[model samples]
Target: MGRKAKHVLLTGGLVSGLGKGSVLAGIGRSLQDRGIVVNVIKIDPYLNEDAGGMSPAEHGEVFVLEGGEEVDQDFGVYERELELILSGKNNITTGKMWKRIREKERRGDYGGRTVQYFPDFVNEIEEWLSSVSQTTMTRKGIQPADVCLIELGGGLSSYEIDIYLEAFGRLRSKYGKENFLHIHLDVLVDVLGQFKTLPIQDSINRLKRKQLTPDLLLYRHKNEINSGAKVKLSETCMVENLFDIPFLENKEQLCGFLSKSGVVECISEQLKLELKSEKGLVAEWKRLHRLAPEPGKVVRIGIVAKYNINHDAYLSLTKAICDCARSLRYSVEITIIDAEQLEEGLEAAIAKLLIADGILVAGGFGVRGVNGKIMACKHAREKRIPYLGICLGMQVVVIEAARNLLGLYDATSTEFDPETANKIILKTENSKENQGGGSMCLGAKKSEILLEDSLAKKIYKNSFVIERHRHRYEMNVEYAEALKEKGVVVTMVDEKTRMPSFVEVRGHPFMVGTQSHPEFTSSIFTPSPIYCEFLKAALENKKCKTSMGLNTTNE
Candidate 1:
């Protein structure tokens, strides 16, 4: 029999949005560096089955896994930092938990006893944690090194959080203290130039009331923790492992900062894991950090989307653009424009679009912002501005092409106008499936580049590629010949489904759209090719404007 895995529970106190996700990623990376196979699980207290239906404005971005699960944005952080592939199971929500329990009860799996929340619900959570950890280990085909890091969402004082604490305490007792470690994260603010510890002290007291004592206290502060404040925290909190964690300027500094502050070492010791030197990892991080672009040259890219209010909704897309810009040694300035604003009028939208060196139409659902996105796409296409479209954004490009170029005024997607001549048709596989939620085509799939002289093929530098997808529509094959008759080019198609995967405009500096989401696979180390090429073109556009000395009103 294999040794049981160790568990680390991280919970936030005082306030939320204290960079808990980043801190968790740093710890996971450090553990991975020490030859430890680590798996991370995120516990969200929301009633939603997944983050897919949540408003990006409120909950942030919904990260899509290769398996097509729309999860919390933190999963993207874990993937980017640890360079590991995660699945839908990594993100556990209260709604998912309740759904499972109710299903079991409906099927009489609970043996007709009244389903209670205490032992039954709590026991289900623990069993789920164990099952997911083992399942990930088996799937990865690696040696069984059971070290799972679970992050509980929301503030420590909330009732939702109390339930998790109760379950965690029970799990600790079942697994033994040596096998469990709890890390508490808190915020420190400067009140009139003096560091305050009262919030965290109160938070710790609240935690103790729930029978949970933190093994480590990670303080998120803007300034340095003075000696007097440190002593006060140590004495009041009764935690010797007190560490100050400042807000990082960039992702490159995460691993280095964690290592320097000895937080990684403290976690390693508490988890009973051997500490290995992170010299190699640190050096690589520093190398990349030094490669960041200097200030001055800025290429502004405008993102037109429905969820422009909350930038977190487009976290991966924004991150991909940043990563690509950094690699090219140019700073990128992003301008987010709500597509609904464009629907109000074209003059205002065009003014904003023209100021950008390039334009990107992001993927979205529903017909709420479709007209506005279509307007933005048309402006980018006609103006010869660098453009990249994704999913619904790509469908917008096809619809615009059919209407403007091919003279198909009635061209539309069945999703928005089921009665109109559908230029973007629903796939046969998805035709009978109900709309919305997880019913759409999801996960990683393969596509082959069909055009040799296309921007997508040039950026990819290959005939074939695999990209993550999360959409229900595809380019209508019936319009392929008509679109080809114009200047529109079908650049790529899926190997199995023969679905059009990529499209481009001939003679444009850079105009490309993809059914697959290249942003999902993008990382700091390896930027997505589509974004890279788009940013590169934007840089050239910026240079042209600088040389010509034309200052636009939007800038």
Candidate 2:
């Protein structure tokens, strides 16, 4: 039989949002650099199948996997840092687990025995973890290496968290101490001008009482931990691998610090795994880090979205802009404008949009703030400011052009108004049949650029491209000719359905929209072409302003 897989369980102690996800991603990347095949799993305690239905303000961005599974935003960090493709299995929510258990119970998998939380529910979770580990071991034809890194959601004191820890204890006993290592992350805050460690001490005490002793204690602090504090932590916690991690300013610094830190060595030693030289990985990371753009000019781009309350809702979009700025050697400042507020009055929204070198309309569901998005698009068009729209944003752009430019004031998406005569945007046939399930188009699809001189075509420099999509409505093909005659250019179409995938204003400087999401594929190493072009246009606009001696400040 093959050797048992090694497990690294990471849990938060003192508080939430203690950079646990970032630390986990860093550790996973470090291990991978040492030729270790690592799989990362996040156990969210939320009672949702996934994060898709949750509001971004409550839970941040819902990262859509290539498999179309919507997961927490940490999956984005994991994918970016580790450079690995994760799936639905990588994310396990409380709702998903319970659903599976209930289904199995209905199928009589327990053989009429009374189903209980312990020994039944707990065993199910253990089995699920084992299955995920085994599947990940041989994923993508890689050599079978049993090293799984699991991150528990929320703090240790929650009722749901206690249940998870109980299962974790059972797994540790079953797999042996050598196969399982627990790393606890706690925060050190400044109190009375001194870095207090009592909160962490109390947290560790709570864990000990629950029979879960941490092998490593990671201290998150705003500033450096003094020698006295470090000694005190060691003496109190009795953890040899005590790490003090200060909040980093940027990804480059974080990667460099993690690579040099001895955290990876301690973990590898505890798991009894041989470490390989990371010289190549270190050089690659340095090269990426050096790609950071110089600080000089600031190109402000306003992103108008309904979920502006939480900037993380558009994390991928914002990150893509940052990546593009780095590649172009241009600095960018992103401002989130609330679309709901814009609906109250365009005066304030226009003021915000005027300050931006470029404007972006982000994707979202429902009709709450859609009119505001349309108004923002109109402002971008009339002002000739660079504009980029995504998904629902694309739909609104078409609607705006149809109404204002095409002289069809009644033009609106059927999604917003089912009774509107000009149904420029119509629901997909499947969506019409089933109002709830499998209606929306999801996942990756291929597209072909139809217009040679369009902005999208120039950005991609390819006649054909593949991008991920998540939307239910599409531009009506019957109005395609009408829209084109009205100065709206169709740049791309789906290779299979021939649906309009990209559109742009004919004479505008950079007004463009995409039915598919380009942000999902954007990464630190490779910025999406559309975003690269958009930022380039914004930089040019900024330069143009400077050349004209125009005041650049928003005020």
Candidate 3:
């Protein structure tokens, strides 16, 4: 329908985890800030339809966006950096790739020909990118925006990513060179006090071998870009110099670097977009500051997660939590507590726990540090502290309550209950024997939340609601009636299947556990309904503590 699509593919030369996600995010933000509507797609090399059922420790938490698609963490980066919202369509893994190919074959869409990897597989990727970018418009929905940024997961050298590289090369011919911009992300190592371009040089050489040359190279490192390295790189790679590092000391410097490279102006001129002042986007970031409470009075919330250091792991959830914080006009401070680290004394953990007005145990798979999360939830419930649980988090709370209150000492999930006689976990009839990826409800599955006149209803303020889910193990239905008798209110259920979706205590200050994930529903302009309530509770708890302290002081 449209003339053609402007495309940008990001690939690396060396290994994985090279900050390619961040560079793409930065460019996405810079363009969107200048009033250029940007769309992003993540092409993961894994051979799964979705990252579902993958360990959060290994594959990172699967992010669900508005359209019920499970995407990569880059979607979160793009949302935070550019302040735009995307759906699962934004993320495409090799797993998701083959799924489409096999479906087409099943439908006889391949015209009875044996569909092999080369042309058929490669064409699926190109078709996916074009279809997604064209359909979901970021702003105003005018012709799929000015540019679509696509990030290739893993490195360019990986055989898994080779198909993606081939697709891009074919796309270049189809869309024309002017309609596409290739960006290669790499690091600039400062070895022995002199910048070594060997790493970057090797990366570029590999891309050249693939017949895909980078239009711009984003060098991401914790150092300055010296003139000599820039020249050597430009002459060798024939790339437009666009160095991106997080060393912007001032506004003047940032504006200068952006203007000098003609990044904003050039993009504007090429895409026929109006170059609005950077202040428009800068103004949006300032809104975050304005929403924060006074510095010392800010509330701290503890995020007990499996992968605490990998901030990318909790991208969408963190953004939703922050969005909730901003909605309540309070500056929120997040303390990352690795679930593995909580094996230490509960007395020692009390300092951090007491400092936090509210505690959130995020979603994760496996049993590596599950005991810590269960312990944290128990402390919150027993201490009457505000708490929120999501997905597997809800399951953890149920198991915790059963063990401590209901006298089930060895309650565990089916995932970990291979030979244990006291395993409280049960397997889904279909999922019990499935292999890997995409086993769970990775997409949007609607479960009716019949909010009773309890704390759950007060926070949600709605009787019936539906949300997304991505997990294999759930509170076993055989044990569900028993748990319900022990005062665990099943606040929500799937109308058709009659499965539990949310559970909570009868009366508490603030506590909720939902089998559905509300993080995917959160956006920049609109916070997730659950997160909004959680932030309100956290802020209100802060206010109540402040009032009580003042009263005691006056007495």
Candidate 4:
């Protein structure tokens, strides 16, 4: 806290979703690899308190922090790139800031003074950044960040984000420009097979209008950016620090790409930091990637989701599986089986689910696709195929076991069917936790998982562990006695609530479910214990099929 943390601002112009998050994380990783204690922050300029309730179809994925905060999907990229467990405090939002202001106003903490935007809002952002800077998140421990990397959500033209621009400008003035570096990212659109430069010039002008200019310009393109286009942007538009960012297959590849472009060296010099390469993060990343097994050994995974059409809805869920598979040296061919599609009929659902080497039903909402997910769980249970369920998916596993094994046919979740007498999965009686999304969330400090000699223990390698959660319904205890008597046991439990958080079926090939979400915590360097073990089972299933003369894949 003694030294002020250096700030690197990353803002996108022309449009959002240009992979600006990747660039920000790439820069952070490049510095962290060089022995700098860095912290990354993501500021979302939205009205929603948090990203928990946003539609996957619209907002892509809702990334849950270890603290149980549901943030934008970019945080997933940040965690993976930075290789650090960031707190929900790292994710700032307009809704969060305004909510605090309104709360203080209602409590008469503001002293009834009519608050204006300029000093008030800017002061709020600055204070938030100061706290974040003082306590940087790292794998080793919490400490003051040497450099703080912030990814400003939305675009330069976004009206909601104009306040951030003004606040950043004011920050530059207060602290001196030497303490801050601005990276403006833009994409070169391929219009009729020709790369455009005029739009890039316009974005620069827009930045100038906001009284902020880019020190480093990170640009994305469909193909290699033409040299002429680059010259025009640099000479004419006065964009001196231009860096070309290309499409890379792996998320970690971004830092290496920028390193080869000499972008890392340029940044360190501009920031005036001692350029010392420590363990070589880029080198280690590329080394691991080069050793990945070929796609010859494929693991077919079927993900049952209500929003199957939107892959981003389950971005972390899918990424966890993919990352785990890569760690075990296997390729994954994911099939998004719509839960609603599975509801047409049990037979229809089975036919669709037959394509999976391992079946996974991720978290979801409502009664709309509840039956389909149950059918998928049933198929996996009966066929003895490796299966993993999460959140709503976990509830479906419990429901399936009750109906088939315990003979409770009317068993259902209160969330899906309130009228059902046998509610296997229902909302908590007294406590209030969204299971895993929304404005308020349980922090990482509270979540606990107590494991036994089950698969959960094998994967986690600990009798007690911590993970994330995102669900309204939990595993009910009313039917727990009978279910446990039938070899369906709750392996891991919420330490405080004593609620069943993780479930595993005995005598099954590989059946596991957890009320908490493991996908949210899985990282490229260390895969989520649950996901890693789940994929390992699928790999074994693949090997078993190959040994018998059965096709390894349904396709």
Candidate 5:
């Protein structure tokens, strides 16, 4: 009962790890460049309610939205690619769909009839897309989306995503063929020197079998897709629109590539939209690549992390650092120092830590590298090095400062050592242990700083600031004064819960920790105030070390 927005269905198959999210986001960026309002919807087929409870090793990073929704990492890609703040409502999972159906059943809205997956599921999905069209990104408000890009995860042939495909079929029928564009995204494999078309053919056949054919075939290759291969694919792949998405080291080139390759032109023609190219979106990427690397002027920041297997676990955090630092015209040199390295030898860890002017301890769960992270906090505090700790990082700051400054040797978080005498970080009272990791203090909360001259107040430029949180343990208010007496103060506290969220050391150049993750909302255009201030302090720290004739390089 609303105006129909153009719907584009993006499917994945024929091997994983293709930059489908980036490409889809790139295409969205291209459309937006032409003054089109584009909104992206990511449909995950997993049974989990959200990515919050998923393992970082198995599922990559759980990107937290501004509204505190833990979504797939692709959403992070979409935000950066489109430079728009999206809402959690845009992410749809099978678990979410099933829950909606059950709720409808409970309310007897289905007239007590049996709910089947065909028309019933399709109807629910239709309603979901319709509701999302009127939803805006960033906050809960109305700003009708002109185009909706639905990216489906779980390979094309999987049974988990068959319902979505079925739903798209009905959607195409209801909205007419012109309103929908189904895209099959995959990589064109090169075996030896031969370019194979069989995999691409087989994948499209699966889509046509479900009566849901893809109008566009956006594929990936290493510049191996020759003219003959393109013609061959066009002839056999059923649908005629074939676009080659070559691999690029810098993902920002996605839109620029799409524009050069005529993919953006074709999408606009097919959708019948009259538009003009602002040339603003692609220009930003060009500016970034145009900057030459500053040799000795680079700001080195050592990141003490526990997850070593997959770097995607810290994907957004790294992006925040690089984006904010670039705004200051300083090239970033991020060294992911494994916390386990510190546990084995403090002397070696200190050697590694001294090479960088600033040290950052990222948030993580488990007791594997707890002591190493605690030692890292102590090192940064005493050495006058700029430091920033997030979630678990903030907890370690308190634990380390309590042990060293307050003389509480047994101080530790309740999450790591529940039997410790000094439970500096107490388990949140609202957290439910029996319910399997659902009750977390998630989303954005208002933080109010008491001191007018505090660094946090200066960085935020406001006494009240809103930040996102994703933790279940918080700094205990019972020992707040005792910690303040030792030159550590809780500068920022949640306005709603009155829980201490931001902490700062008295005499350090820059030593601050927050229970919230500031990187989630950090953008190059409008960088996070905390990250901007932290990087500035790190640059100043480097200047001081250089004046002292200290060798900051690892070599």
Candidate 6:
């Protein structure tokens, strides 16, 4: 309820990866637990609307919010811990700003005044950030939030991130130091069994160059922080309120440390705002909980994807699955299988699929794991196991059907093979060639659900619903007839774009593939329509196990 927002900007020192996002989310979660309405802003240094076009192997998977924001994965942690849904305004990146500035120019909003970098570009970015902060608070039915967490993406000394640095400098003056809390995530390396403190010093030097010093120096390491190591880190970093927190590599202690260290309380006191806990909200949410199935039966979901190798990539999905499982009162176990690890002849893989209560090929990019996912889909279709494919997973299902069921051996996504003979999944016509940063379906776009008494319809038990999307390629309409002929039902089409959006298998207990990333739209209390149905199918499988007298185990 202050004129100036309580701002916390997290910036990394030295190299890029230092778990700034984790720290920010941890603090937000701790404060929200105290009943504070937290709004997070993720400002990526890269020039992109979102991180959608980036490779999952290089940058990790783009974590989408319930409102369909293709944002940095840290937002996933924030939403999961705080148990709140963030709108599209929660994320910002260089590409998003440039596009906005260009649009303003095109609309003649500048009134014939030519825009320049300093006051023009920087000012626009600042305005955008403030607007997002205000708008999100207004939408949440709370007074302007007691605190706003902002993450400056990449690192402090990033040459490419100069605009963000300058913008923050101006913002610091606007809010004054009293309302601002700066935290730096510093990484220390171990060279020849001795922990070298050079990285921490060099990191602090760069932050000093921006005329900003951290209120807290977070030494990121794996295990416990030793006294010698702490002294060495403090000597190098030399911050007033230095604290040692574990890296996100081990995320268990993240929330606890933030709460115990008084980081949330410190910020609230500095910002002169009352700290509110979300415990009441969480308890209220718990009160409305619908129990899952009895412990007699269990459902096992095989989530096949490239990012499965790292649990962080699927954070939001894991939360949603847990929520869905709780809703049905069914004991659910999710096994993450690396799609790229599939072997030839697939008999062993098929055996794994048969044991699963349902098969889910999750969203990812590249050809590295394509054939393996396609193989899983083929096995699911053959064995009649409940199957659910999302985003890139849906493309895999469509590609599999195009090749085996429809006899198109060359079916492929243009992202994998631009010159493939059967480009069953083509890039949007408006997409530019060779743009990696943001040239993709970046925001929340709706698709219509047309039910036909199919599995998808039975799961939703309704028609005409909207879900969020973040994908560049979609199934080619030319292959729609062929797929339908093979009993692969094209249940839903893009209402506005008239594109092929969703497909379901005929007579299958539950088999639905959507071009959109359904994981982005799922929440702790409210599951997306797609995931709700997937859980329903998973529950059915668990009931079958219960009928077989198999006791459920919650592992």
Cα RMSD of all models vs. native, in order, equals 2.6, 2.4, 4.6, 2.6, 2.2, 5.2
Clashing pairs counted in every model: 0, 0, 7, 6, 0, 15
RMSD of 2: 2.4
- Per-residue lDDT, model 2, residue 338, is 79
How do the candidates rank by lDDT, highest first?
A: 5, 2, 1, 4, 6, 3
lDDT of 5 by residue, 1-555 (tens): 776678888888755567778888878877877787788899998889889988886788888877778899998888876776777789999999999999998999999999889778889989988878654464344567778888888787677877887788778777866788788888778988878888888988878877777888887888656798888888898787888788987766766787677876777778776678675877776576456655556788999988878878899899999888777777888988878889877676667777877889999888888888887888888788899998898888899988998899998888888999998889887898855446888887889998987888888989898888889899999888999998889999999889999999988889999999888877666678888888889888888878787756422
Candidate 5 residues lying further than 4 Å off, grouped into runs, are 138-141, 288-296, 346-351, 553-555
Give the alpha-carbon lDDT of every model.
0.81, 0.82, 0.71, 0.79, 0.82, 0.72
Best by lDDT: 5
Superposed by TM-score, candidate 4 places the C-alpha of residue 178 at a distance from the truth, in angstroms, of 1.0
lDDT of 1 by residue, 1-555 (tens): 777678889989856787888898887766776667788899998788998877777888878888889899998898877777888888889999999999999999989998988899898898888877753432356455558888998887667767777888777777766788889999887898799889999988887776678889998887766889889999999987888788778766866787677776777777678766553665564576567686655788999988866768899999898877877787888988879889988666667777999999999878888998988888888877788898888888899999899888888888788888554555546645564667677889899988887777789999999999888778888888888878788889999988898888888888888898899888777788888888888877777777778546223
Candidate 6 shows a clash count of 15
C-alpha positional error of residue 391 in candidate 4 after TM-score superposition, expressed in Å: 1.4
Please give the lDDT score for candidate 3: 0.71
Off by over 4 Å in 2: 135-143, 292-297, 346-348, 432-438, 551-555
lDDT tens per residue, model 4, 1-555: 277788888888767878888777777777877777788888999888888778888889888777677788998888876777787788889999998788878999779899778788888999999888655765777777778888898876688887888888888778765688888888877888788877778888877776777888877886877788888788856867888888787666777877677776776777777767557787876665555776667788888888866668888888888787777788788888878877876555555578678999888777888888888888888778899988888888899999999998999988778889898887865445444454232445233445456877787776577777766668788898899898888887777878888788889989998877777777667788778777778877777777876663333
Q: What local lDDT score does residue 508 receive in model 5, on the 0 to 100 scale?
A: 84
lDDT of 4 at 72: 89
Q: Candidate 4: global Cα-lDDT?
A: 0.79
Q: Show where candidate 1 strays beyond 4 Å.
A: 134-143, 294-297, 346-349, 422-428, 431-435, 546-555
For model 2, residues 108-171, the per-residue Cα lDDT tens digits are 9989998888888788888888877753522255455558899998986677777788888777
Best of the two (5, 6) by TM-score: 5
What lDDT score is found at residue 251 in candidate 1?
63
Question: What C-alpha lDDT does candidate 6 achieve relative to the native structure?
Answer: 0.72
